[model samples]
Target chain A: MIPNLIFILVFLFASVLFYFKVRTIAHDINLGKPVEIRDNRLMRWMHMLKVAIGQSKMISRPVAATMHIFVYVGFIIVNIEMLEILVDGVSGSHRFFSFLGGLYPVLISAFEVFGIAVVTGCIIFLSRRNIIRLKRFWSSEMTLWPRSDANIILITEILLMSAILTMNATDGILQARSNQHYPVVGSFLLSGFLQPLFSGLPDSTLIFIERFCWWFHITGVLAFLNYIPYSKHFHVFLSFPNVYYSKLEPQGKIAHMPSITKEIKVMLSGNIDYNAEGSAGEIGQFGSKDCRDFTWKVLMDSYTCTECGRCTSSCPANITGKKLSPRKVVMDMRDRLEYLGRNIRKHGKEFKDDKSLLDLVTSEELWACTTCNACAIECPVNIDPVAMIIEMRRYLVMEKAAAPAELNAIFSNIENNGAPWQFSNEDRLLWADNLEIKTN
Target chain B: MDRKKIEIPVMADLFARGKKPEFLFWVGCAGAFDDRYKKVVKAFTKILVHLDVSFAVLGKEESCTGDPARRAGNEMLYQMQALRNIEIFNAYEVKKIITICPHCYNIFRNEYPDLGGKYEVVSYVQLLNAKLEEGKLKLSSELFSGISVTYHDPCYLGRANNIFDEPRLILNSLTGNFVEMRRNRRFALCCGAGGAQMFKEAEKGDKEVFIERTEDALRTGAKIIATACPFCMTMLTDGIKYKNREEEIKNWDIAELIAQSLDL
Candidate 1:
């Protein structure tokens, strides 16, 4: 009864916490532009299934891929044990696993071995993250909390599984001594090792230890669920929608530049009078300087990043000694949005200062990008960093009139001569005239 | 200036009169303007005529497709120029527009749609391949006597439009000995001429991207460097000159090869 009550209280508390965190993230993402769908419904579903469930993104990296597969499989299979614990705690009878017949014990044993393998695999990943520090893993922008939280969660999981083994061993010993011929005594392989410690303990003492472990396991699961929405673990939920809604157009296609004349006409002629109301200037030009400048889809992308470092690792700019890391750009945008949300909540509609977020990303980092889609192609979460970079460049070029001198000269030449070359337009047909081919 | 000029027959009313020509040859800006490219364009036209494909030229009515302007962020000018070209195309009722230049092909096929223009666009290699398959074009026994060649995949044709096979197929069918550059197909390196860089000087970097790409082509140790795009041909030719490798390595458009190989 006590164990059941503890499990219910912890589950309810965690559920409430998760609800609020998810709400805040959803609200902020909807504050930007709406997502445009280009792919057919069937194609979108196939992509989602392949990328989200198949772990296509994670498997791109071989070593990490293998480790993740084991952990994912173990977590899914072990969920049945969680249900059993919940039921047994309420009824005071651990019959769930036993009801499956002769094969149930074998299945449990197989899962037990796989759980140990998952624990081992996780340990390897933790060591790699801290010691080997692979370039992709090192540059990941995962929140500081999630990294340490993962380690704690793994250790606690190992402990809970160990406790389960110990309780089973104790029960086997007690039953053997009481002449209760149990069919599963042969399956409890750890009984001989645990006999020295719990052979003299009373059956009641053994039962108390089992109940205590059951409560710890349930509480740990609840805590993880509650913390998921607030941590980098939020990617688990966001990754699906992010991949499904990913841009289907060719990577080189730039966003359609909005008509400048139409916007100006609307501002001047509309009854609402945006210019008169002081919301816009005489020559209206829309550009994003911070997180809010991005569309809602871009904002969602920022939060959906798993910080897997696939993007940064594949980035030519980063590989060639440039300061721009596409992953960092997305993370920085997310951080700024969160910061601005806090300010808006406190100051309401009058809040204005975004100088800090603007300062976070430099023009050098922005210009260093070659607009290559390598980062986007490599990202497991389908975050289009190239689009974000180009969007920022558009703002820099069109609104601020700030760009590299050479690029500026090129644009000027194109505007004047209809070519990037400085030569006279009269010489344009010189190549044709020199050819042996007859003119029309 | 005493070179034998190849005559390109003019037929502005061919499409309007419902005459089904073998091919509608598109003479791009480079083909019409660049000195070296003009010879190659003439050669390409002669080869198509030899293949018995009745072709027509746009003559003085042809204008810039505005690809350079669009790529350089001058969208307004691109729209203006594109609209003008669309009017010409519509007037001629051009159905299948074929060009030796990958840039012109890309603009006509991809960018023209955004400006409300539509036409069936094909590259020179694609048209030539069809002729070869139909046995209209045949390879000569004289194989240039052991001259090795390597094909450079232009960004527009290879990456932008996923056209890597047709050029290679034509080259392989023409010459038994053909090698590939290290970076080919989708992973091919840019010739630094893309995104309107051909019209402007390259920005300061450790090395010129075009030169680097040309070096990759030269590293294959082939006697000749072949390309389908006029921009790439011009850029690679200049790169060879810059490296003082003009004496060692030569550049040729695919059309020039077909023209030279023809029994005519």
Candidate 2:
């Protein structure tokens, strides 16, 4: 009864804290303008299932993807055990789901297997980040916080998995001793292998170990849940929604500005409305200067980046030693959005932070992009860094008129000659002037 | 000045008689103005005429498709140009378009619909593949029987549109000797001309994208580089020139290869 009471109080505290943190994140993402991505429900759901739930794009690097899928699947399947643990915690019932006589062994064994797999996956990933020292994890964007954040998540997961297996191990031994209220639950296939270590412990010591593991596992889960909102690990939850709302148009198409389209329509109709009040959401600037200027989907995309650096590794500009790192583009946007989120929490919704995304993402990085979409293709979670780069580039070019000189020259040519070249429209026929072929 | 000139029918000339051709041969800015790509326009036109496919040119009525403008973030200019072109296309009631340039093909096929301009658009490679499949065109295997040719995938046409097989199928059916670069089809490298980079010099980099892509092409050990997009043509051509492989390596549009290998 005492254990149950303590469990309830701690769980309530963690729940309340987690609720407010999630609310803060949602409020911050909502600061951006609404976008129409909710259409095509069936298609969106299928995309989410394939890209996020299935981890379809992760296998571009076969070995890393295979290891990641084990942890990803383990993370999901182990949560069923988490549900049973929560029930046991609340009711003070040991082995709460032990009623399924035949299935109980199978379920506990599967949980043990998954727990071991999670530990193994976490260890391999931790070594890759620290020991092997893969260049991707050490890219310029991954400073101390990101580096430590990745390590912290891995270390925390290893500890949580250890607690779960240890709990199962100690519980199995206690059940054999005919302890009161300790039912003879089925053997945990993987954790049973560890029973020898607790073979001869006293009843009071065994009980202490079991209770400690139980508390540690539950508290660790809650802490991990709250930690997700602050780290790139947030993608574990956001990837599904992000993939669902991915831009469904042909990959080559860039959406034209609707406000500009309306203005052009008004101009074509020869209606003189220069003095009239602009329409709602008049779009004061031509493109994104800050996170708010971007669409809600883009803001969501900023939060979904996994910082795996696959996007950066596949980038042509990065390969060619250009200033652009698509991964950095997403990370910088996420950092700025986090800043805005914090400011709004401290102040109010209308809080103005003089800082902009441009300060974090340079014009050099923006211009260096070839808009190749390789980064988008390589991203395991469907985060589109190129789209954000282009959006910011749109701001740099349209608002500041700060396009590179060659682009400025081409823009003038397009205005004057109706082409990117300096030649006139009459010269458009020059190539065909001496060709002997039927045109009509 | 000592070259033979051909008579081309303008859309206005045909529209005055209340006539509409089956396809508007969209001679894009590059195909119309770039000297190197003029041969591609001529070659594709010859193939269309050889197959007796009814097509007409907009001639002077056609302007830039504003692809570079749109990519360069001059959305206003892109919209204006797109709107004007749509008016002309709608006025002529154009039903279909074929172009040798992927930039025009991409903008016309993917983007124009958003601006209230919608029409069936196909690149010359797709049309050639269709023509070959339909038996409207035939190739003489003897033309390129012994010549080794490798096809470079234009990013806009291949990756952007999933058009890998059409050009390859045509090249394989025409040249019996067609090889692939290490990075071909969806994974193909950009020729560095995309995103309006063609109109501007490349940003500061260790090496040009085209030069690296050219190195990929050279690794394939093929003498003839068959490309579909004029932008790739220019970039790869410059790459070959940069490497001083002009005497050994050459770039030809797929249409030119098909036209050369035709039974006609």
Candidate 3:
């Protein structure tokens, strides 16, 4: 009973700490962005409801959806099992779930059915991932933890659930031998098969084994709770904010370019003080080389990505033989930011000037983007890769002047001639001259 | 021969009557410059005149609206052009305007508002349909016999401004055999003319977007491919030639059909 109380206190304390740690990380990443409250209140609410509660966006692919649904439902239904574990720890009794006469049986049966559902779902999921080898389900950035952790968690859950069923059956048999009324016939039937092995065992041995299984289940759940913030399983909490704070603007509106003309004027006038705030360093308008250049919202978007390849599949530029995959762009940026953040956290002042990590992204990949919003539109998590691309382009154009030659020519043509075409305005009226029409 | 004198005469006539029209008919760069569209513009003008709706033209003073400049990413030139047009309109006290070209209509109605310019803008088809509904203009049925036509919804008019039904209404009133392309209205494909692609050569793709759209119109099996935008008409006409299907398919602006149906 004392151990059970300690377990409850430890679990509650760990969960609260993990929640705050994730919240702080999310908050720090999203600090500078303008708050994007969508204009349509009802539409926002509906989208939130569909994405957060329904898991509608994550279920886009069949195999991944099935696997995720099992894990998700297992996490939910297993809470009742968690209560049983806690109660067992408190009372030192294996029949903790059987407290309320008929109610206990009903609850046990419900959990048993859900456990079977979860096991079958996870089995299908594992087979699909390992055997079928679906390319879309594979993430280049999948960490070691979730990959192995998921398998371990699933196996442990199944074993724990099976052990609970076995314990109940064994208890039913013991109860029947002692002449106590057992509620479930299936429990008695299950116990009948195990009665021969248990007949020779002492009562104290059964009690010790039941207590061992209860402790194992309780510890497994507590460990999972502590591990949530440190792992990719953090997406469970992050998905809600990711869906709610989606970009409200039309996809076509690219990130606003900084007014370089005003800055250039001030710089040339030798009044560096006046233009100090807006002046670019010697690198010029090149492109985003590091995480600091990314908008705060983009950094948030990076962490929120489920590594779903829906963005990659729908991207027009990627389909058209371009090196630009919007999914890779976000993932690569996230990788670079994480790498840089790790270095900054560890080495601090010593690695302040270390530009080697900035080479994580290439200039070609940055320039190849068409700024099409297909990635943003198809992204179930509302990750705006287009916004990130535009920010990178802004840096390339303003800081480095390193944009493609074709784009420069286009700008020049618009500058010198009134139109993109060099055609003489004298001949503009030629198409209208011979028509049999009255002038306005 | 006096260009300025020629421009202000229509405005002078409006001033002489001590009354200003609701809109000045801004016959845009395409309407004033494209030969095929000029006839359509003239037909629209005739309809307005017959309906006794007062309007004036800017004549030679009206240049390009800089939609071509803006779409090509030269915001400076676009701003200059837009500012110049706004000044001229403000000077004339033109509170409302109508344009025949959807590109011009979109620039004037939608884009110009962003540059501190605002005016009630209408497409000619909208004005024409309203006039028709008011019974101010009448049409003869001789233009309709054996004329199987289909309306190609220009992307700017349909998708950009949501002006789908006005053109369809005019076509329906003019001819009974107006078929629709498989992708019509909002889903209408671009004729590869928008975003300044009309002035420049098309980018190399697996298939020409213009040709693809033209073939869609051709597949409708209509003799006449009717459109409301001058750019669509020109591109679709060129697309027909490129596909070697010009003999099988012909392009006509909606106003031209309406003009042909007019008793005059």
Candidate 4:
């Protein structure tokens, strides 16, 4: 009863902490304007199911997908065992679902199998990062902290899996000894291999090991739950909703500025009517200057980034060794959001700062994008770094008139010559000017 | 000035005569102006006439489709330009459009609809593929059997619009020796000319994007590089020139290849 009371208190404390962290993230996201991504509910659900739930896009790279699917599936399936653990924790019972007789062992054994898969997947990923050193992991934006964050998560999973197997192994030996507490649960397929090693231990020591493993596993899970909100692993939760809310248009379409369109139309119509139907949203600024200026979907995209560098790797500019990396752009945006969140916490939502997102994302990086949609297509979770890049470009071009000189010339040419060059529209048929061709 | 000129019907003139063509040929900014891409326009128009497909050019009545302006982040200019072009289209009651440049095709099909300009837009490759499948057009294929050709997937046509099969179908039917680069379809690399990069010099990088893409094309061991987009044509042509592969490798628009192979 005492242990059960302690378990309840710990669980409550962890739950409260996790709730507060999630609330802060939601608050940060709410600081931005709403994006109209709610259209086509059926299509959105289909996309979400295919990309996030089914992990279909992850399979584009089969080797990584194989390892990732194992880890992803294991993370979810093993957590089912959490239900039994929670029941046992609160009720002061051993294998609380053991009353199911034949079915109970099968479930526990399946979880043990998943735990083993998780360890194998994590080890493979760890080696890829640490030993084999995949180039994506070592990219510029993956600084010491980000690198350590990934390694820590992988190591934590492996350690957690080991603890589960150890706990099961010790419990099996205790049950063999016919202890009063350790029930004769069915043999766990993976963890049963460790039982012979602990067979020589006395009943009292086995009981201590079993109780210690139980507490450790429960505490570890609670800590991991809180840690997710702070780590890149937040994608594990956000990828589902992010994919659901992803852009469904043809990939070529840069979102048209409806507000700008209204302004242009009003000017074009020569102001015949003093009042016109302008855009519903405020056309106060041309483009994004800060996190709050970005759409909520863009903010959510930054948060959903796994920092996997798939977007960066496939980027044409990045491939040619340009300064722009899509992964870095996303990470910087997320960092900026965290900074804003902290500022709002400290000095309230009205807090102002001189630093803008532009301070981190340079104009050169913005200009380097070919707008080829490679980065968007390559992202497993559908995080569109291009949206932020183009949004910032709008800010530079419209707000400050700070576009590159050549682009300025091109714009003016299109405005006057009806082309992107200095050629005359009267000579538009220059291609056919000196050629004989059959015509209808 | 020794070359002879031929008459191409302008939409305004046709409209004045109370005639409407089945399709509007959107001779984009590049098609009308860029010398290299001008040939692409002629070649494609040649095929349209060869198939006796009724099409009319807007000629001087046409203007920028606001693709470059939109991509360069000048939304006001893009909207103004787009609004003007839409007025012309509406005036002529254009029902269908055939766009040779993928950038123009993308903007016309995907973006112009948001600004109340909607029409059935087809890329030239899609039209060619349709004609090929419908048996309206035929290529002997024997004329280019020994000439190894590889296709460079224009990003706007491929990844942007998911148009990987149409161009391949056209090329496969035309060239019996067609091969794919290592990165094809959704994974194709961009020519250095997108996002207003054609007008401006490249940003600081270890190498030019076109040079890297040219290296990919060279690796395929195909002598003829077939392109669909006008911008891709210019960039790849420059890439071939820069690598001094001009004497060995030729970058031709897919329309030119079809026109040549069909003995037109």
Candidate 5:
């Protein structure tokens, strides 16, 4: 009864903490401009299934995809065992699902098999991060915290699987000794290997070890759940909705800003009074200046980014050693959103900070992007870093009037002469002039 | 070279004569201004005149599609240009447009519809491939018999719109010597000419993007680098010149290659 009470208290505390943190994240994302997804609903759902559930995009890199599949599938399937663990903890029982006769052992044996796969995958992943040191994992933006964050998640997964396997191991030994609590169930494939280690121990010690593992496993699962809001590991859940809400238009298409559209329409309709100061108070907000300026989908994208660096690796500018790293751009968005989100919570939504997302993702990094869509296409989670960069550029050019001098010339040339160069529109058919040479 | 006269129809002139062409030839800004890309426009027009595909150029009335303006974060200018172009297309009652440049094709096909300009926009490669498959166009293999050819997929054409197979199929039909660069199709590297990069110097980097892509084409040992977009054509042409491989490597647009193969 005491153990069950302790379990309830721990579970409730974790749930409450997770709920509050997740609410903050949701609140922060909601602060962004609400985007209207006017795409086909079926297509969106299909893409979500293919990208998030199927993980279809990860298949490009065979080795990493293969290991990732083992880890992803194994972790997901083993979490089913979490259901049984929850039941056992609440009732202060051991293997409560064992009443299913032979089926319980089959179910547990399957989970144990997957648990082994999870452990193996995690070890290989750890080696890839630490020993082999894949270049993507060690890019300039992948600071100490991010590297350690990845390691912590992998180690935690391995440790959690260990606890489950160890718990089953001790439970099997107790069942073998015909203990009152642990009913006689057939051995699991994974945990059965370790039964002999504890077989020599006394029943009292075996019970203690089994209970300790059960307590530790439940507590660790709760801790991991709460850690997700602070970690990149939250992608496991956010990826689904992020993929669903991602744009359906051609990758090259940049979404038009309706606010700008309205203003332009008034000017085009000759509604602008040139003499009047041009909406001076509203001049500050044009493109994305900070976290709040990003659309809801972009904010969600920041949260969903796993920071795997596939986008950066495939980026042309990044490949040529340019300042732009798409992964870093997305990471900065999340960091700024978190910083701003915290401030908003403490000082209300209207709190204005002098620091913008551009301060972190410099205009230099944003300008280096070619708007090629390579980064967007390469993102495994369907995050469009290009969209964020373009939004920031819009802020720089439209609101700040701070485009590069060359581009400013290009803009005026296009505006004045109907092309990006100094040539007149009358010179458009000069190519036809050469064809006329045949007549002479 | 054509000493023979071929009449290039203008939309204003054709419509003035009460004759509507089947397709509007969108002579993009690069197709008009760049000296090298101007040849692409002429070659493509030659093919259209040869095959007797009814197409008309907008001539002086044509304007920029604002692709560069939008990409450079000048949406106000982009919208202004887009609105002007859309009005001209509407005035001509244009039903279909054949774009020589992928950037023009991309803007016309994808972005223009949002600004109330919708037409059956087709890239030259797509149009050429369609003609080839329909048995309307034939290539004499003797023209490119000894020359090994490789294709550089333009970012606008390949990754943005998935117009990969059409260019490849056209090249394959023309010559068995056709080869692929290391990063072809979706994995294609940019030619350092996108997003207003052509108008400005690239940010500090170890190697130029065009140089990197040029190495990919050079590594293939293919003599002729076939391109579809004018921006890509200019970038690769400069890349070849920079490496002093211009004599060995000829950067020709696919339209130019097709025109040559047809002996037009």
Candidate 6:
């Protein structure tokens, strides 16, 4: 009874701590400006179902897709068994669901099968990342912690699955011996094979092993739940909502500010005196300088990136040896947002950080993008990294006047000649002058 | 050689004579200034006249649609150019527009609507396909017999605007046998002229993007490298020269192929 009370209090404390951590993340993302992706309700739901739940985009690369699906299904389906574990912990009983009679053994056997699969999948993924050194996983952005965080998730999952299997095997042996509080049951196929190893153990030691395994499994799960927000593994929770609110417009269409459009309308109406007043007051700044200048969806996109490096692998600029890695752009945004979140939490609402997202992602990286939409297309979670890059580039040119020399010349040419060339409007018809076609 | 007579009316001239034509032919910056692209402009104009499409040119009144400016992050300059063109277009009450350049087609069709300059715009490839569907233009299938051609998709027309089928439809109507590069349609590589990269030298790289894309075209062994956008024409032409295969493979715009096939 005392142990059960301790278990309940610990579980409650973990849940409360996890809730506050998630709330803090929500607050950080809410700092971004408003964007209207709220419409198209049915389409958004369909997109989530297709991309996230169905894993439609994952299959583009067959090997990774197959291996990932095993881990995915195992993680999701095995959570049903987790509920029984939770109940057993709270009630201080062993094999609490064994009351279901025939159904209980079937469920345990299925859990054993999935547990083996999960371990297999995790091992393969860890080996691929650490041993094989796949080019996608070894990009410049995958520095020490990012690399280790992935390994940690995989290793923790393996240990958790192993603990569950060991607990079931030892408990099965003890039940067969008619030990106190151990109910006899049919063999769980995979766990039953391991029963021979614990056959000679005394009852007290066997009970202790079962109890240790149960505690380890539940505590590991709680720890993993808390660690997710600080890890790139946050995609496990964010990918669903991220894919749901994805942009439906044609890929090349940049977001035009209606506020800017209204200002342009007044400027073109010939009522505003440009030379006398010198400028339109409301015309204001054009693009994003910091995280707050970005749209809320863009903030969500940064959180959704899996750091899988698929975008960087497909990027033309990255492939051509440019310093622009699309994956790095997303990681930098998240790092800056985390920095600002930490600042506000420590120093109250009035705190200002001297650093900005520009310090994280450089001007060289911003200028290297071709705006090809390849990164956005390749992202499994539909994260639009190029959209964020374009917004930053907008800030560079509009506010800082930091465009390259050739672009500045083109801008001047367009301002004066109404074209990207040096030719005047009077010379526009010169191409057709000597042609034999009839002209009026 | 006797030049075929064709009638091209300026938008201002038609508006002064109390005449509003069916469409405004947007002669983009390349069609107006680039020397080699001028021939492509003439070929497209010849096809439009032969089909009896009532189109008028903005001529000196037409300014650049400022696609390069918007792409280069010059929002202020882009807006100024867009607003100036919008004012001219609304003054004449222009309703429909056609252009042979994909950059102009994309800007007019996609970008202009956001700037309050809404007009029905179509590229020459789309226009030619629509004319054929409407029975307004006819093709002589025997015009170019036994010629193998591979079509290169311009990034703006194919991926950006989703006009993949229109170009293929026009290609199918010609007499030449059509083949595809390994990467075609949505997965097609860019010709490296987009996003104002054509204005400056390519950033330091192992190989130029166009050269990479051209190598894919050459592997197909097509005699003619077909293009729709002048930018693709120039890039692929340069790519062929770089590979020293200019004598073996020639870049032909889709409009030039259509005009020749129609015997216009």
Q: Give me the candidate number with maximum TM-score.
A: 4
**Please, what is the whole-model Cα lDDT of each candidate in the order they appear?**
0.69, 0.85, 0.63, 0.88, 0.88, 0.83
Query: Can you tell me which runs of candidate 1 are displaced by over 4 Å?
Result: A36-39, A55-68, A71-97, A106-131, A139-217, A230-233, A258-284, A356-358, A423-429, A434-440, B1-4, B8-88, B91-112, B123-161, B167-264
Q: Residue by residue across A117-199, what tens digits does model 5's lDDT show?
A: 98998999999999999999999999999999999999999999999899899988888788988889887877999987888
- Please tell me which predicted candidate would have the highest lDDT against the true structure: 4
State the lDDT of candidate 3 residue by residue for B90-126, as single tens digits: 8778899889887778778866776667999888889
Query: Between the candidate structures 3 and 5, which one is better when assessed by lDDT?
Result: 5
Q: What lDDT score is found at residue A428 in candidate 6?
A: 83
* Fnat, one value per model: 0.11, 0.57, 0.04, 0.75, 0.63, 0.43
Rank ordering of all candidates by lDDT, starting from the highest: 4, 5, 2, 6, 1, 3
**Which CAPRI level is candidate 2?**
medium
| Candidate 6 residue pairs that clash | none
Query: What is the TM-score of each candidate's chain B when compared with the real chain B?
Result: 0.92, 0.96, 0.90, 0.97, 0.97, 0.96
DockQ of 5: 0.59
Cα lDDT tens digits, model 2, A193-282, are: 889999889978888998899889999999899899999899988898889989777667786688778777777777756666654245
TM-score of 1: 0.77
lDDT of 5 at A194: 91
Summing lDDT over every window of 10 consecutive residues in candidate 1 chain B, give the lowest-scoring window: B1-10
TM-score of 5: 0.96
Better of 3 and 5 by DockQ: 5
Q: On a 0 to 1 TM-score scale, where does candidate 2 land against the true structure?
A: 0.95
CAPRI verdict on model 6? acceptable
TM-score of each: 0.77, 0.95, 0.64, 0.97, 0.96, 0.91
Q: After aligning candidate 6 to the native by TM-score, how far in Å is the CA of A34 from where it should be?
A: 2.2
lDDT of 5 by residue, B157-229 (tens): 8888988899999888778898888777877888988888889989998989989989999999999999998
